[model samples]
Target: MAESTTIEYLCKFCRAVVEVFGPQYLRSPNAEDTTRILAQNEAREFYGMLGSIDCLHWAWKNCPFAWQGMYKGAKGGCSVCSNVFAKLVEGHAPPVNFKVNGRQYNKGYYLADGIYPRWSTFVKTISNPVPGGKNSYFAKCQEACRKDVEQAFGVLKSLFAVVRQGPLAAVDHQVPVAWAAFLNMRQEIRDPQVHQELQKDLVEHLWRLKGNA
Candidate 1:
């Protein structure tokens, strides 16, 4: 149950990480996320849901040997952006394929914390949520659904027990040259309009789905 770099092999890593994913691991169905059914089953409000993102700091399981020098942080390499989830913001992750509360959303969102940028793809819980209103009810449902992410990570750590795994995380590194792409990515993540709309839609959707229950 120990995760290490010295253990260089295929079958072990495959069985641990690959087989766990199968074909659905790399190639999602029709350019959409793979966790829609599971997430929706967990909560109807998560109709077009991806998976939850948390703030649990994880060691970078695999950092490029050359970049390790610049990637040191309190938690190993801080939190590196996973390609699987990074695709969400990169404009290639998913298409506008699902409808929630009558509105269409292209990107399936992850449940993140307030530390993350306000992007449509990341949803965070309300702080000091006033109880008994939509805010309170939405907060309750969001928190409940987020528990699955915690348990999922627990299983991942148990299986590969080395570097902790973050579902979707950001990194702190300073070696960049692509100003064009960087600016664009920054623009998208900082869009308050999109974040506001997504949060509103999610609040309405979750309220309708579980508020009465």
Candidate 2:
């Protein structure tokens, strides 16, 4: 009965997520209209950046010991970690006509940590710094911005205790359902004016800091 109930609960929540956010949030954006203006503001030349990508571990208490080898990470716990992006778009696809440095590109990029592979679409943080200069400055800004992924996930785990505690058993579809819930909860501002104002403030602050450094 307990197993059955858990399965049913997962099914119900999963359905609720799809019904609530599918049409508007999960579907891919129209290729032509999705611009990279905000991302460009974050970094001078990094246009068309989708968001930050990273992995986080969630404790899995009910895992079988036999399976621990595969599920356990270096942290020495039975946990499930997901490689997820801070931003979500419909169809998990990026818009075409993506350009960077005056070169036309086919896909958008995600900022990630160094552990992730070096790919055209993944921007990894610099491991070593060379005193105070643009390279170090860029690394600082990149890391600060990439933290959005961790902070966003932190909010989700806070709101949904079930996620923080981990499900009794993992379901493949639960990840997307959780992402849907997170997107709704994050309450992103759609007003261009609000974003513009915030961006202006951020740019000024960062430039000021650079001058001081």
Candidate 3:
């Protein structure tokens, strides 16, 4: 009975997401908007980038002990790992016009961490960046940009108390519902003054680190 109920609820939630919010909140950007995205990326010194890519785990507090081994890891909880990437670049598509070091390319990229595979589409910070050089600068910038994903997660968890409860402990089943909520929430808090102030402080801190390096 519980299994059937879970399935039914998941279906209804997913359907509602697609019918109501998918078109507006869950789409890749059209080509016309690419220029704006490029400008934003250039400001962060990451030309041709769409956004940061990362994952977030939503813990299943009531997960069955039998299956816990599969879902549980060092994190000490049975959790569902959500691909927390697409939402960040919603309305942004790939095959973007990118230029770096005077060379032009035609693919957008995401700043990611080391666990992700090395691909042209994902830029990982230097594990051991050489100090006082291009690698150090790039590493700093890459990490700074990558925080967009983290901030998005933080925003969702902080703003939505219900959502903070591991997506109602059915995150694996209600991904669409969670994503819909996140999309709506993102628009509401696009860029508050406090975030801008914090960003400025971070930029200054990075510059100081660069100078010291």
Output the number of the lDDT-best candidate: 1
All candidates' TM-scores?
0.62, 0.51, 0.52
- Residue pairs clashing in model 1 are none
Model 3 TM: 0.52
In terms of TM-score, the best-performing candidate is: 1
lDDT of 1: 0.61
Q: Which pairs of residues collide in model 3?
A: 29-91, 29-92
- Better by TM-score, candidate 2 or 1: 1
Q: Which of the two candidates, 2 or 3, achieves a greater lDDT against the reference?
A: 3
Q: Please report how far candidate 3 places residue 160 from its true position, in Å.
A: 5.3
Winner on TM-score between 2 and 3 is 3
Range of the 10 consecutive residues with the lowest summed lDDT in candidate 3: 166-175
Please state the error at residue 122 of candidate 3 in Å. Answer: 1.0
Taking the tens digit of each residue's C-alpha lDDT, what string does model 3 give over 156-211? 77886544553322212223346576675454334344233323333444565567
Candidate 3 global lDDT = 0.57
- RMSD to true structure for each model, in Å: 7.3, 11.6, 12.3
**Candidate 3 wrongly placed segments (more than 4 Å):** 1-17, 32-35, 55-94, 160-213
Q: Higher-lDDT candidate among 1 and 3?
A: 1
lDDT of 2 by residue, 123-194 (tens): 666668675755566667768777866687788888876457744332222234465656642333233343
